[model samples]
Target: KLSKRYDCVVMEDLNMKGMSQALNFGKSVADNAWGMFTTFLRYKLEEQGKRLIKIDKWFPSSKTCSCCGQVKAELSLSERTFQCECGFTADRDHNASINIKREGLRLLA
Candidate 1:
C-alpha cells in the first residue's frame, strides 16, 4: 500500500535496541518487530522503485516546532503534545513526522 501510494517514505533511524535496554521497555519495544518491518518495507519499496529515507536519530524532530520552527531545549517522552512559545502546538509524534518528512525531502532535493 505504501509503495503504491507514495514514491518515498521518510523515517528516523532510531536505536530501538539501545532504547529497549536503556529505557527498560524491552518487551514492548522488541515485540514491535520494527527492524523486521523496516527491512521488509525497504525491500518492498525498492521492488516498486520507491525510496525510503531515514534521517538521523538525533535530528531533534520532536524538539523542533513544525509550525514556527522554534527548537525547544527539552522535550520529555511523556509530553505527548508539543507546544512552542510561537503559539504552535501539535501532537508530538505528529509534529515530528512532519519534520522528518520535510527533512527527507530536503535531503532528496
Candidate 2:
C-alpha cells in the first residue's frame, strides 16, 4: 500500500550490526528485524516502479540545527530538545525529521 501510494521512500542507511554491537539493546534491535523490513520495502518499491533514497548513516541529522544548518560537536541522546547556539530550539526528533526531509529532497533533486 505504501509503495503504491508514494512515489519515493526515504530512509537512513544505518549500520545495524555496528549499532547492535555498540548499544546495550542488541537483543531488542535484532528482534526488530530492520534489515528484513528494509529488504521488503525495497522490493515492494521496485515492484511499483518507485525509488528508495537512503541517506548516509554518518550524516548528523540529529545534531545539526534544522533552521541554520549548524552542526553541533556533541549532542547526547538524553537531550530530548535541540537547543542551537543560534537561539533556535525545537524537539530533537522533529528537528531531525526536518533535516531528513531536506536531505531526502536534495537527493531527489
Candidate 3:
C-alpha cells in the first residue's frame, strides 16, 4: 500500500548488528528479522516500479536540526527529545526522519 502511494522511499543505512548489541534487544533483534523484512520490502517495491533510496550511515540525521539545519557536535542517545538553539523542539526520531527526508530529496536532485 505504501509502495504504491510513494514513488520513492528513503532509508538510512544503519549498523544493525551494532545497534542490536548496544540496545540489548536480546532475542528480539534476531526474531524480528529486519534484514528479511528489508529484502521483502525491496522486492515488493521493485515489483511496483518504485524506488528505495538508502542514505549513508555516517550522515548525522539525528544530530541535525530539521528546521534550522543546525548540526550539533554531540547528541547522546539518552536524549529522546531534540531541542535546538534555533527554537526548534521535536522528538529525536521525528527530527531525524525530517532530516532523512530532506537528504533523500537532495540525493534525488
Candidate 4:
C-alpha cells in the first residue's frame, strides 16, 4: 500500500540492538518488529521502484530547532516539549518529525 501510494519513504536507521540492551523494555522493543518491518518495506519499495531513505540514527532530529536550525546540546527524554532559544516551541515528536522530513528532502535533492 505504501509503495503504491508514495514515491518515497523516509525512515530512521535506529540502533535497535543497542536500545534493547540499554533499556528495561527490551522485550517490548524486540517484539515491535521494527527490523522486520523495515526489511519488508525495503523489498516492497524496491519491487515497486519506489525509494526508501534511512537517515542516520545519530542525527539530532529531536535536538535541533525546526524553525531556526539551532541545535541544543542536551534534551532529556522527559522533555516532551521542544523549546528553542529562538522562541520556537512545539511538541518534541512533531519537531523531530519536521526535522526528519527536511533532512529527507535534503537527501533527495
Candidate 5:
C-alpha cells in the first residue's frame, strides 16, 4: 500500500537495534521491518526515478506537533504515544510519520 500510494519514502535515522533494549518499544520497532522496507523502497524507487530521504534521528519529528507547530520540551523514549500541548493526540510513530512526510515533501519540492 505504501509503495503504491507514495512516490518516495522518508524515514528517521534510528538505531533500531539499540531501541529494542526498552521493553515493548524495541521489539515493536524491530518488528516494523524498517530496514527491509527501506531497502526494498530504494531499489524499487530507483527503477522509477523516485528515492528515499532519511531525516536525522534528532529531527524532533515526534516531539513537534504537526498541528500547532510547537516542539515539546520533554518527550521521552518511554512515551509511545504523543500528547501535544495543543491538544493534538497521536501515536508516537504516527506523529513522526506525519512530520517525516511533511519534511520530506518540503525537501523534494
Candidate 6:
C-alpha cells in the first residue's frame, strides 16, 4: 500500500559505528541484518521503478534542525532525542532520517 502511494525512497549514509556501538552484543547480532535489508530494499525499489536517494555522509543531517534550519551547538551519541530551540521536537534518529531525506531531495532537485 505504501509502495503504491510513494514514488521514491530516501535514506542517509548511516553511521555504522554509532549504530553498532549503541547496540548490546546480542542486539548487534540482530542488527547485522540492516545491511541485508538495505540491499533488498534497493533492489526491490528498483524493481518497482522507484529510486532510492541516499544522502551524503558529510551532510550534517543530525546536527541541523529540519524545521527552522538552525544548527545545534552540540549533540552526543547518548542523546536519543532532539529538542531544538525553534520548538522542533523528535526522536534523534527520526530527526536525522527526516533531515537526510530533505537533503536527498535537495540533491535530486
Highest TM-score among the candidates is held by which one? 4
Name the TM-score of candidate 1: 0.93
Worst 10 residues of 2 by lDDT: 22-31
Listed per model in order, the count of residue pairs whose N, CA or C atoms clash below 3 Å is: 0, 0, 0, 0, 1, 0
**For model 4, how does the per-residue alpha-carbon lDDT over 1-109 read when each residue is reduced to its tens digit?**
9988988898789988788888766788888989999999989999998889999999999999999999999999899999999999999999999999899999999
lDDT of 1: 0.92
Residue pairs in collision within model 3: none
Candidate 2 lDDT score relative to the true structure: 0.91
All candidates: CA RMSD (Å)? 1.1, 1.2, 1.3, 1.0, 3.1, 2.9
Q: How accurate is candidate 4 locally (lDDT)?
A: 0.92
State the TM-score for model 3.
0.91
lDDT of each: 0.92, 0.91, 0.89, 0.92, 0.83, 0.78
**Which 10-residue window in model 4 sums to the lowest lDDT?**
22-31
**Per-residue lDDT of candidate 5, residues 27-103 (tens digit):** 68788897887788788877778777888888989889988889999898889999887899999989888999898
What's the lDDT for residue 88 in model 1? 87
Q: Over the stretch 1-109, how does candidate 1's per-residue lDDT look in tens digits?
A: 8878889999999899899999999789978999999899899999999999999999999999999888999888899999999998899999999999999999989
The TM-score of candidate 5 is 0.73
As a whole number from 0 to 100, the lDDT of residue 16 in candidate 5 is 83
Poorest stretch of ten by lDDT in candidate 1 = 68-77
What TM-score number comes out for model 4?
0.94
- Superior candidate under lDDT, 3 versus 4: 4
Better of 4 and 6 by lDDT: 4
State the lDDT of candidate 6 residue by residue for 1-109, as single tens digits: 4345667878876766565666645566556776787787777778899877777777788888888989887898798888899898999888888888788788778
